[model samples]
Target: MRKEVFVAEQRVPEDLEYDEFDAGALHVLAVREDGVALGTGRLLYGEAAVGRTGGDPSVGSLGRLAVRKDARGLGVGVELVRGIEAAARGLGLAAVDLHAQTSASGFYERLGYAGYGDEFHEAGIAHRAMRRSL
Candidate 1:
């Protein structure tokens, strides 16, 4: 579902859609009872995550979060985020950070992430940096 949304639908440039960090990052997939992926997210820890979270060693970076368009408003994204946070907690991380599309900052704020940085363009879309302590 994430590939469909982040890559195909959103056209997030294939090169940027995936990277070397994937090998070491923890990936979380949201699926239905029958095993269909509804959404997906990933957590970057240690050195590989520095750039994504502004070099905060105690923080894990959450990225590649995407939900199937059909699954929007069904809470799949919430579960995907919870799963990523759980992964961060398991790794002894103290917080999580993400570059959220500005339009979706409210959604992340509602989930406990606080936006702090000036808005910027990422992949040609307005974005804001947000953080949440575990």
Candidate 2:
């Protein structure tokens, strides 16, 4: 599903889409009543999130968030984020961090995340680092 959104849809390179970090990250999924997956996201905490979270073990890094095209305009994305935050709290994290795609930064900001640092590129797309206290 992440490959569908990051690779096929968004044109992010396949090799870059899946990484060593995936194995240690906590994945969250939003599925349909019929068991079809509508969206997905992941949280990286502890040592796994150090690089993204600025070496802050107390902050879980949220990433790989993707909602299917048909699922847009629905609340699946928001729910997935909330679910990730819940997972972070479960792990005793004090905050959640993410490198959000520039296009979707506003959406995250609306959800109470605040951006920091200048924009940067990853996989050919611009992104901004953001965080929210849990």
Candidate 3:
């Protein structure tokens, strides 16, 4: 389902969808009651996640968050973010950061993330930096 959203529906280049960080990151998969992957997200900690926000050692960066189109509005995204936050807290992280697509900033803001920097383009889409303390 993550591949469907991040790779196919969003047209994100395949290489960017998966990277060296996977092996080191803690991934959370949201599956259906029937046992299918409905959505996914990752919590990055330690040195590997440093570059996510220009080397902010105290922050855990949430990345590669994707919910299947069919799963939209099913509360999957909310659960995924909360799961990532739980993982971050387990790792002793003080905060969490993410490059939220501009369209989703409000969604994240309601989840407690605060926009912190100028908007920029990523994968041809507008994005803004957002953060929330764990």
User: TM-score for all predictions?
Assistant: 0.95, 0.98, 0.95
Clashing pairs in 3: none
Please give the CA lDDT of all the candidate structures: 0.90, 0.95, 0.90
lDDT of 1 at 48: 84
- 1-134 in candidate 1: lDDT tens per residue? 65698779987787887889988989898888999888889899999888888887889999989998989999999999999999899999999999999889999999999999699987777989999999
lDDT (Cα) of model 1: 0.90
Show pairs that collide, candidate 1: none
Best by TM-score: 2
- Residue pairs with clashing backbones, model 2: none
Candidate 1 global TM-score: 0.95
Give candidate 1 misplaced runs (Cα > 4 Å). none
lDDT of 3 by residue, 24-107 (tens): 889999999899888999888879878886798889989889998888999999999999999899888999999999999998
Candidate 2 residue lDDT tens string, 33-102: 9999999999998998988888888999999999999999899999999999999999999999999999
The clash count of every prediction, one per candidate, is: 0, 0, 0
C-alpha RMSD in Å of predicted model 1 compared with the true structure: 1.0
User: 1 or 2: which has the higher lDDT?
Assistant: 2
